[model samples]
Target: MATATGKNAKKTNKQTDTAGTKSSQKDGGSYQAKDIEVLEGLEAVRRRPAMYIGTTDARGLHHLLWEIVDNSVDEFLAGETDRINCTLHKDGSSITVSDNGRGIPVDKHPKTKKSALELILTTLHAGGKFSDKNYARSGGLHGVGSSVVNALSTEMIATVRRDGHEWMQSYKRGQPTAGVKQVRRIRGHGTTIFFRPDDSIFRRTKFNPETIRQHLEDISFIHGGLKIFFHDETKGETHELHHPEGIGAYLEKITTDGQKKSVHEIPFSTEKDDRGNRIEVVLHWTEATDEEVRSYVNGIRTHAGGTHESGLRTGVAKAVKNYMDVHDIKAKGVTVTNDDIREGIVTIISVFLGDPMFQGQTKEKLNNPELSGQVEGLIRPGWKRGSTPTRRLPTRSSAGSCSPPALAWPA
Candidate 1:
């Protein structure tokens, strides 16, 4: 009888164990299609802000400025605007960017039935950039910059002066608090955006003035005639950056500040391709062994570099090699490489391409393969132009005299 009781107990324990296993699987392991959550509109941005703007840290904080400034830069590129103003509030809580470009459209959007300004600020992937009619080439081609900034901010206000009137709208965490309303009549045409980044969404909300100044200076240098002004209300200081010489001034500053020696006194070259793509390069060799190359496509800086940089490297190497060969100079053992030619070189390559292809959302690198061939073709002619067997190391004087080949526009 005791043996029989033991067997019954064992069966009950086995049943309890099975029941526990089933309960655990049901609670922890059950995943079905119903479990998938579909975030709509700006919700997706709020859900994964990092995917859009990179991070919620200092880098992302500064990206907000870049996005707003890029819109104004695009205006300058399109021959519409001449000035951009950026202001940081005293308490380090908000920033305001204003541009003299054509203000954002205030008319009702045909598709959304809302003011164009409202649609752009609240909806993801909505803007004038998608169409080439408004912009031939732009840094904010993705149309995500403003909206992403809006979604991540706790409060946003958009004010536009266009069509002889000033219009305004306000938003709270990506949702419109009110429709577009006329603020008053205005004399100028432009748009002003003010926003306070949500402290809850970001790691920190303090704005760095130095970082803002540096980036604004870079933009000013890239766009020759456009002026950028930065005012820090907190510190009661102001800075205005205008570079008429454009990238030439930029190169001068970098080389002078770093005290880098240049192989050429005037270190600048420019060429244009048939497709309206313009290439400008400024380079010099420094005493330091490090190599620095900064490249930009349209107005967007590509820190990672891409095919354009490769083309520049290839062209420089080929040019140097050809010069050596023509002079009967031979390397001792190993072949002279691009690395050898690029040692201690500081180069800035700026290309204006109609439609630039970038590798990722942040546009850290350019990936267009055609740009390589175009740049190579443009640079090779300058090197090969008056070469003879007796020519010595091509000096700055001789190199400058060689005019760039006639631009070949696409048929």
Candidate 2:
């Protein structure tokens, strides 16, 4: 949170080396090529875990869980799976994620000459999601922490069911404990992974089932077609989250959970799916002084408002302007800016696109420049025509859904 100063902020001067290569001199100190230490494979992740997962705290520990679950969610995005299972063991420190989808490839990698499954677990930036050939849209952009998670975990076990056979592999702190072995012949396809976060790396080792369930529930609302089951052995409780109502249902839950009173009865929502790309938005005016906007890209929440959030606000503003223009309304000579239009706004936006640009490996912010415009384009028309001015404040809930030709406010 502090500004950079000192050595970290020092500018380097370029100098020619004995080999005619450029050498960097920081404040006239020796900074040669050999001074650079390269951390290979998952070593870098272990040395600087925060650089990959944001923190070595409880949140980052859960993030490791999200990394695995998100990969399964990617399979769902690819239309390869429908169900994802998350389990917390009695110890509350070990967990597992299972998905019924096309399993990770186990064949030898041409360049690395290692099994694809092993390569993906042991290396960084190695996975089927580098391009859209396997997944047109996925949430595991820079948070593809499979290798990072493996590096930070004290124990990890992977099981894959594909190619009409079952394969298994075990690892401890990113290194394989045994070679990948074919366990048995299997009929279906899917993947299962179990891991325990390293006590030395993470400040917190135990996990909260409530926290995990809330996340799974939120994810269910984002990807409405997918089913997520959370089993908390610690409490002997299981929760199933499958919200086909999508973001619309989520808006209601948000309002109720926060006890926020809404100026509108039924939230205005719109969703459009073109091939694999999809966008869903639900918004309402609230009595709250500040605005609340929950946004996501490919089902991963963007806590830091990004371009897409800006687009949602812009789109809302544009719609309000269009409505006033069509109705010949004015603000009594007062300069009613976009801020006025969104003063008490409550909104949720979810988008799934082929290629997403995130701010960092944490994937907490999306930086896709085109998303601002694309989201605005989609939302502008939907908003202008989605609602009509009511004579009175809206009351009584009407049918709310995110799927559509667009939505209208309750009369």
- What C-alpha lDDT do the candidate models reach, one value each? 0.80, 0.82
User: Residues 1-411, candidate 1, lDDT per residue (tens digit)?
Assistant: 344368798998899899998998888766777899998879998888889888899988888878888888998888899999999999887999999999999999887788999988988778887767988878887888899989999999999999999999999889999989998988999999999998988999999998898888887888889899999998999999999888878887887778777654545365675477788876656655667888988878898999999999887667666656665665434354567556667878899877788886778889888889888776666655532222112222322322111211121
**Model 1's TM-score against the true structure:** 0.87
Writing each residue's lDDT as its tens digit, candidate 2 over 7-53 gives 64543212224223422343335766889998877888899999988
In terms of lDDT, the poorest run of 10 residues in model 1 is 402-411
lDDT of 1: 0.80
How many angstroms is residue 193 displaced in model 2 relative to the true structure, after the best TM-score fit?
Answer: 0.5
Q: Write down the worst ten-residue block by lDDT for model 2.
A: 395-404
In candidate 2, which residue pairs clash?
Answer: none
Name the best candidate (by lDDT): 2
Q: Which candidate gets the maximum TM-score versus the true structure?
A: 1
What is the lDDT for 164 in model 2?
97
